[model samples]
Target: MSTTLVQIQVEEKRFRAHQVIDRLALDIRAGEIVSLVGPSGCGKSTLLRIVAGLETDYAGRVLIKGAKPQLHSPEVGFIFQEPRLLPWLSVADNVGFEAGRGGGKHPRVGELLAEVGLAAFADAWPKQLSGGMAQRAAIARGLFTQPALLLLDEPFSAVDAFTRMRLQDLLLSIAAHHGTTLLLVTHDVDEAVYLSDRVVVMNSGPGRIAGDVVVPLPRPRDRRDPALGRARSEVLTLLNGAQQDYHDIAPDIAAAPPAAAPIDWSKLSFAV
Candidate 1:
């Protein structure tokens, strides 16, 4: 049996008086790829932040490898929607930034850059590289520490479709090679189905897990496979149902007044 690499139990997570997440529990096995797909404001990104230890003002316990996740820990890597590369740093430097001074000279930096097909651009500045290239560099950087888990928040959304597909394949290849587990947040259903071993569907209005769809197919997956198509339909169905449920509660929300207490954003150290 696969070991559970991550165990999350969020009894409730509130943003001041507004409850954002309720009764959420999820377990991710080692080396498994899981995708969270839902409507906007469904708390997917928030959940990812919680797992990364970037959002701590919540009621929950998140364990990675049997211990609480630590902020900026080498065991966990994060890739946001944008590449977020520092323009002053070269491709190689950005990849090894976590290693401190002369990071670009790190041997692992060279290996990671080569793995992501950016060895030639080691000396290139972020401003000179294309969007896809920058994201690739981000991936290399995310892997530099050989993290056990990588958290991606719509990491490929900024790229074009063709580039997105290429990056998806590249991600799969690298994940397989490194045996790194992944928890990805994406709006693209096809992308979710193609990349994830399981797709978790969530609903908004105090976000909660609506359902889950398992893509019981082998890797090096054929995008055109009938099984994949079926899985996609299943995900869409769950989303549609969840959407309807959210709409059903719209009238109640419209009638309700604003939250009595609001969080002071500036005071909080963690991202909301």
Candidate 2:
């Protein structure tokens, strides 16, 4: 059996004393792309953060390659919603930041810039590039580290529909070429279904894994394929159902369980 690239077991967490995620478990294999789909504030990004070791106060274990995650380690790379490039840096400099001063001279930097179609904009500063180009530069920056796993949190949410579609294709092609394991968090069910090997649906607040659907469609997936349309519908159904279920359970949860009294705020302490 192939070793898992990322693993989470019985993970739970709260932000500002309000529960966010609870009892989340997942195992992702190398070279596979897993997309987390849910409504906003469903803890998809929080879960990605926890996996990336950005937050450590959460309960449960997260293991990358059977070892604890390290933020300083190059094993994982993260791509956020925004491009977040330095205003003064040129496109090539921003993407090649991980490399030392002389490192931009590396052929891989040019190759990656070309792959993301930013080769022509190499000398363009952050302000000079379009939204899509900046985001592409950010992607190249993330890939510059050559991580074993890539965590993307709504990386295309801000882009136009046409640009979003193109980026999705680029992400898939890049992941396929490098055989990088990817975990993408997105609200777009169609985008999730189109790009993932598996789609993991998360419940609303106090998020948990509600559905784990395998995408059996052969890749490279055609976004317009009828089979893909059906898959998208199925994922949407799961997301909608999970949202309803959470809504129905909210009232009961608000009324604390009789045996297990209300949590003691005084004794509660944040994890390190």
Candidate 3:
């Protein structure tokens, strides 16, 4: 079995007494991909922040690869919802951002650009790139450090649907090739189901773990597979249940759960 790579034991995480995560314990194995899904303000991102050592105003322990993670640990890489490229930096320079943070040089900037299909854009300014291209550059930057783990915060949420799917595939491919552990926060149930080895559902009103489920499908997953649909439903059910519990006191907040849309079996194969 793969050894544990991340251990989170957050006793209390709060924003000036507004609790975010409390008594939330989670373990991620090396090379595992875990997605966090829940209603807004459920502390999913907060949990990632704790793991990455970005937020220290909490009471708890977060161990990455058997030790505490530092801000520039070189063991963690992050990609945010926005590309967050520096305007003055060329595409190639942005990709090397992690190298500078590590206080060393990354000799693979060109190789990394080529890997992300940005070889031609090496000299391009951030303003000249499309949303997708900029995001691709961010992806390259995240992987340039070759960290043992990557944390993504709705990295594809800003892109078009088609572009989102492509980025999801790209992320998985990169993780698999690099054997990098991944923890991501996403609001899309389809995305959570498709990209994660396990989907962790959280509840608001102080942010607690409601469910953790394993994805049963094999790799190179077919987005249109009935199996994927079933898995998606399972995760969605968990999310709805968590939300229902959180909103139990407020009947007006209890939403009518959306019905599952049936897929056209014949048209699925043609779906991009």
Q: When superposed on Cα atoms, how far off is each prediction in RMSD?
A: 10.3, 10.5, 9.5
Q: Put the candidates in lDDT order, highest first.
A: 1, 3, 2
| Higher-TM-score candidate of 1 and 3 | 1
- Candidate 1: regions farther than 4 A off: 252-272
Q: Candidate 3, which segments miss by more than 4 Å at Cα?
A: 101-106, 249-272
| TM-score for candidate 1, residues paired by index | 0.92
After superposing candidate 2 on the true structure, give the runs of residues whose Cα lies further than 4 Å from its correct spot.
251-272
List model 3 lDDT by residue over 138-214, tens digit each.
Answer: 98888887899999999999999999999899888889888999999999989998999999999887799998879
For model 2, state the Cα shift of residue 92 in Å. Answer: 1.3
Report lDDT (Cα) of residue 240, candidate 1: 92
**Order the candidates by TM-score, highest first — what do you get?**
1, 3, 2
Q: How accurate locally, in lDDT, is each candidate?
A: 0.94, 0.87, 0.88
The whole-model C-alpha lDDT of candidate 2 against the native structure comes to 0.87
Question: Using Cα atoms with residue i matched to residue i, what is each candidate's TM-score against the true structure?
Answer: 0.92, 0.88, 0.89
User: Which of 1 and 2 is ahead in TM-score?
Assistant: 1
Error of 3 at 190 (Å): 0.6
Backbone clash count for every predicted candidate, in the order shown? 0, 0, 0
Q: Of 1 and 3, which scores higher on lDDT?
A: 1
Candidate 3: C-alpha lDDT: 0.88
> Clashing residue pairs in candidate 2, if any?
none
